[model samples]
Target chain A: MKVVGLYEYLPIEAQESFLDVIVDTPKASGHDLLVRIQAISVNPVDTKLRASKVTVEETPRILGWDAVGIVTEIGDAVELFQVGDAVYYAGDVTRPGSYAEFQLVDEHLVGAKPINLSIEEAAAMPLTLITAWEALFDRIRINPDADAGKKLLIINGSGGVGSIATQLAVWAGLEVITTASRDETITWSKQQGATHVINHRKPLLPQLKALDLEGVEYILCLHNTDAYWDAMQEIILPQGHICSVVELQNPVSMSLIKDKSVTVSYEFMFTRSKYNTDDKVRQHDILTKATQLFEKGFLKTTLNHVLTPINAATIKEAHRMLESGKSIGKLVVKGFEENDEQAN
Target chain B: MKVVGLYEYLPIEAQESFLDVIVDTPKASGHDLLVRIQAISVNPVDTKLRASKVTVEETPRILGWDAVGIVTEIGDAVELFQVGDAVYYAGDVTRPGSYAEFQLVDEHLVGAKPINLSIEEAAAMPLTLITAWEALFDRIRINPDADAGKKLLIINGSGGVGSIATQLAVWAGLEVITTASRDETITWSKQQGATHVINHRKPLLPQLKALDLEGVEYILCLHNTDAYWDAMQEIILPQGHICSVVELQNPVSMSLIKDKSVTVSYEFMFTRSKYNTDDKVRQHDILTKATQLFEKGFLKTTLNHVLTPINAATIKEAHRMLESGKSIGKLVVKGFEENDEQAN
Candidate 1:
């Protein structure tokens, strides 16, 4: 299999930071599906894991999260997938990722790719869509069956997760207020289903109050958990729920939310898969719904920028773009092209 | 009205601590009730509030959270109380407290005293019962409506709040595992409704494993929030919930809960009454339910000790007893002398 991986942690400026190498492809076993990668997307987790490596690895660590692929082989234990089925998934953190020609993923983590989109477009939908789906539907309990007038604020609504979150919230019929600092990002967020845009650079309270809202019913924080602690504490209504994907560096004063009778929850999409929980298949269910929604025109792909045929320099450039904190949406690179593209 | 308060923050050894004085009896306004206190209970909040002084108060601060009393006056907006109703309540923190002979409380915060219990027993309940109820039914969502057949860990199950929390968890049909260090407390916890008792002095993980359990579904922490953070993080099942009544002085890591998709909520019973939220009267509803539960033998008072004739020295003794961290169950001091008690 043609794969990209790292043997040592180095700055993105280093020449051999991400290498395109070859590893033997393993047979699909149990519920695994051997998929031939068509497109791949990079997320913040990839950049973070890359920068945190302290020791040289015995084997190169393959790093990628999002992918649109075609299943070429299925394990005998698999009932959900078959050879030649098109699929998309955000591969698991503890295993080899999708930066490869052929990768095996659990059937339970794979979703059918949308019929109306190209591979890059479908690739952009999985990771962010999965996170947004879980955060709103699973964690915050927004009812897709009912058309209630619920309001949701998505902090950092122009980022990859936020772009998908804003769309999902709107699809669920919520009044979506999103935060963005730049004018271009704000306009882009509105195009992605945000009803209103507020500046994340300023205090959120006055902006929320100016919008004729005493407090929002739900807040899905996509960035800066510790920074928004005080504002979230002040702006969430009594009994209102808040879910965040960001981790706080310090222990927060949860006491601030005590008087509001509010609920604060963490939304990590990997939980069920990580724990092998009784409800692990729910991820498969969510992804199926997301695929349908995308085809139904309720969701649009968030692939803002796409790089050419996959390689070392391109992978390093993708990481650098994410680290710059200015990427509007997801950045993806697809396929094996120029021969040197595969080498470190 | 006669009142006991601290003009200055003093060590318990000071003779003038919790001094007796005369003050104007406040009139009821809005949802307020002028209650003639019959009995009052000492909780950890009392000692914490007493040991600490208000920089802005020139006179004195009175601290008492729990009370059994007679409603002697009702506010113009009051619909829940009458001039002679017997009541029990855990009052708001930002107000002068029930240490005074006639204290004004919001009617919504008061519940009818249980017909099955005496004044001392009723007095011992309000603070702890409310804390327990909010933690279990509201925050942790144990669902008395469903079979939460899963086990719950109530850390510090012999404390005032824990005594009630254990009972509530049992009432919700959960398998109750509680931690109590002393022999009498362990016995008392079992009597209250604990299925099993573990020693907090021992390592919690080993104790849980010895009980033939892998992990608990919920944990209610009633003491030492900072000290138990790591233990709770380890033993909580993925997607489980945790609630605590105490707030930590320093920040603790919230990231631990993220990977598990777990929820950690703060339960401060004073929240509704303190903020006078739209659902504030729900406290009245809970107290009503609590009274019937107590009378019907579904719940029982946790009063373990009582002091006769509430006075400065007896109250100080109660404070000292709480500070020693040895008191099991609830301790209360009756208002005035038996003959003088009627004088209020």
Candidate 2:
């Protein structure tokens, strides 16, 4: 099977960053599903993994996580999915990724794709949806039914995770406050159901004050946590919770929230797959529910940009766009073009 | 009314560290209750506040938080208790504390004392009980019924808060792993219902490994947080919780738990009272439940030392004992001596 992957970690501008190669397609066994990849999306994690410290692999390493695909074969232990089922998932980080014609994924991590949306649209939702869902309902433990009157602040509300988080938090009956600096991003955030929008470039306190909010009960930080750490500390209510998906480069003082009795939770979407936790199947359940919400029109896909032909060139361009830090929402690559074999 | 207090912060050994002063008895209003103090306990907070910055007040500042007393008067809005009702409470930090013969406390912060325990025993419980209870059920937010199979680690398991925390955690059906360096403290920690005891002086990983444990689901830190920060970070399970009452001197990086998706919460028992939150009454409910548990013998007093006569000399002595860091459980000062009036 043909695959687009990397022989070494290198800058996108480097000539040998990604390569075209052929390898034996993996077989399904013991709860694994052999998925024929249909579409995939690029996230910050993809770019980070691609540009990280150099490692020359004996064989090219595949590097896609979010994918929509068809199950061509199922392992003996598989019960959630069957052959010919269309599925979407943020596949396990430890396994070979979805950057190929055929990819293997654990059945527990795959969800039935939303029938109402195209494959590219469905591909954008898995990673961001799982992240936003777990960060809100699992890590922060906000009960959608009981959290009606509370307020949540989504920092960087127009980003991949933030756009979905804004919608989900609002759907959970929370009053949503979001931050977006650009006019286009601000309009997009508002369209995502943000009750109030503020400029993250400016100080947050005055914006909260202007909105007649003293402090938020929940903060979902999708942007730079270090830059907003002190502001988040000052703006979170006593006994409030803060969840962040962004990893910090520098240490943040836990003492900042000591007196307020605050809680800070870190949410990494891949933790379940990485740890093989008892609740790993929760991803399937979350995505299943999200599909229902999407079909009912409660959620709209965050995919704003799409590239055709799944190959090294298009993937590299997607990475370049993401690394620029100006991309809005999700960028996806659709079906492989028949003529792309010439590039290989 | 007679009060044991200070005009300035000083070392316990100083002559003027604490003084016997006479002040007019305060009247109850709003939700306040004027209690005739019978006994009071000195916690680490008292010692820290005493030795902190030098502040000279025109009126002497009283410094006690935990007290067991009789309600002498009730405000118009008081509904939880009546005059002559025996009560126990950790009075608000913003108010004149329980160092005086008569002190005013909000009824919402007071609870009916357990009839089975002595005044000194009851006094030792309120502050520590509130701290431990909130750390487990509120901050860590462990559901007692659902968390039966999980493990909890309590650092400094024989101190004022840990002594009770170990019991409560065990009662909640969580396996309790606690830390104590000294043999006496280890024995006490076991008596407090810890299933496993590890010496905090050594690296905790070996101790945990020796017990056939890989990680704890919950960690309640009552000792120095800075000292245990790294170990707690290393020994916490994926998506686990860590709660600390100790204020850190230096900043600890929040990045340590990023990949594990761990939650770190700060538990200041007085947060509700200090902020006057709408949920301020939760403390009342917690203490009321604690009283029932105490009466049923599921929980026991942590009062290991009791000094007779509530006076400046005995108060200073209690402070000295706590500051020494060798004291086990809690220390209390009993009712005022009749002839000690001459000392004033």
Candidate 3:
């Protein structure tokens, strides 16, 4: 199968940062689905992993996570998916990724693609949707039907996860307050169902105070956690819950929230598959719900940009755009070139 | 009314550290209940407050949170209790406390005293019970009935909160593992219903490994958070929850748990009272349930040491014992001297 991978970690400016290569296609076994990748989304994680390379690999390292594909083969133990079914998933981090023509993924992490959306649109959602879903429902344990009158603040509301999180939180009946700096991004956040918008470039407390919000009941941070640490400590409600996707560069004072009894959780999206936890199948359930919601008009894909001919050049450009840190929503690469195909 | 209080922060060794004073009894208003104090428990917070006094008060500053007393009068708005009702409560820290002949407390924070225990015995439970109850059920959101086959680790398992937390976790059907440094403390931890006990004075990882345990699903920390932090990071299962009652003396690297998506929460028993939150009445509900549990023998009072004739001298001595940091379970004082009381 044809693949776009890296032999050594290098900046996007390097000509050889991403390469087109050929590798033996993996076969499905033990609940695995051999997927024929059709489209893949580029996220910040892809850029981060590309830049954080420490050791040179003997073989090219594939680096995609979010994909919309068709299951071409299934393991005997597979129960959730079958051959020739359209599927979408943010596959396991420990395995070879979806940046290839053929990839094997655990069926438990795969979900049926939304019938109303294109493959590129579906590709943009799996990773960010799973992240936002787990952060709100699993980690924070917010009951969509019960938590009325509560409020949520989404930091960096123009990002992929923030776009989906804003809509989901609002659908769950929370008064959503989102942060966006640029005018276009602010308008996009409002269009995604944010009840209020604040600028991340300015002091959050003053903006929140103007909105008559003393402290938010929930905060989902997609931006720099260390930068927002003090603000989160001051403005989270007593007994509030905070979930962040970003890693901290510096140590944080855990004692800051001691008096208020606050909960701080990390939402890595890959924890279930990384740990092979007993409830790993819940991811499939979450994505299945996402499909139903999307088909019913309760959700729309966050894909804002797309590139054709999934190849070294396009993937590198997607990574560069993500690294620039100005992209509003998800960016996807689709359509394998006719000359790049090594298999059907 | 006669009271024992401090006009300034002082070492317990000082003869005038605690002084006996006379003040007019406070009247009940709003949600307040005027209680005639019968017994009180001394916790580490009391000793810390005594040692860290920074400001001189014009009037004596009374400090006692855990008390078992009779409701002498009820405010017009009080509905949970009427006159002459025997109650137990960890009173608000903002109000003048129970180191007096009579004290006024919010009725929402008071609970019916357990009929099966002595006054001093019941006093040992209110504060610690609230802390443990909130930490497990409210903060960590552990469903006592549903979390079967799971495990919990309680650090400093012989301390006031740890002692009660151990029992409550066991009652909730969790296999409880606790840490105790001394032989007596270890025995006390076992007596409080710990399924297993380890020494905290030694390295925790090796001890847990020797018990054939890789990680725990839930961890309730009653000791120094900074001290046991690394061990908690290593031993908490992926996506596990950890709750601590102690404030960290140093900053913690939040990035350490990023890969595992761990949740860290602070469990301050006074949060509801401190914030006057909408769910402040939950504390009263917890204590009421605790009374039933204590009566049915599902839980037991953790009071380990007692002093008679509540007075300035005895309170100062209690402070001395607590400051030594060697006291096990709870230290309580009861029955004021005949000559000290200005009220019957």
lDDT of 3 by residue, A1-344 (tens): 99999989999989889999999988889999999998999888888888946679899999999998889999999988878899999999888887898889998898999999988899999999999999999899899777987999999997899999998998899999999989999999998999899988888988999988898999999999999999999889999999999877777776658989999899998899998998999989999999999999999989999997889999989998998889998999986887234211
lDDT digits (tens) for residues B159-189 of candidate 3: 8999999999989899999998888999999
Model 2 has a DockQ score of 0.67
| lDDT per residue (tens digit) for residues A223-300 in model 2 | 888899999999999999999997666666666598899998999989899989999999999999999999999999
Among all windows of 10 consecutive residues in model 3 chain A, the one with the lowest summed lDDT is: A335-344
**lDDT at B13 for candidate 1?**
75
Task: Report how closely model 1 matches the true complex, as a DockQ value.
Answer: 0.52
Instruction: In angstroms, give how far residue B199 of model 1 lies from its true place.
Output: 1.9
Give the per-residue lDDT digits (tens) of candidate 1, residues B233-301. 889999888887876667777766899988777888877876677778878888999999999999988
Model 2 global lDDT (CA atoms, 0 to 1): 0.90
The TM-score of predicted model 1 comes to 0.92
Backbone clash pairs for candidate 1 read: A251-B251, A251-B252
- Report the TM-score of candidate 3, chain B only: 0.97
Q: Mind giving the per-residue lDDT tens digits that candidate 1 earns over A1-344?
A: 77889999888888789998988987899999999888899998888788856799888789998888889889989999889888999968778888888888899988998888788888887888888888887677688676357789999999999999998888788999999999899999999999899999899989999999888989999998899989998888776789999877876676677666677789887788778888788877888988888889988999899886777878889999999999898898887674323211
Q: What is the Å distance of residue A303 in model 1 from its true position?
A: 2.4
Which 10-residue window of candidate 3 chain B scores lowest in summed lDDT? B335-344
Report RMSD (Å) for each prediction in the order shown: 3.3, 2.4, 1.9
lDDT tens digits by residue: candidate 2, B146-166? 999799999999999999999
The top-ranked prediction according to DockQ is 3
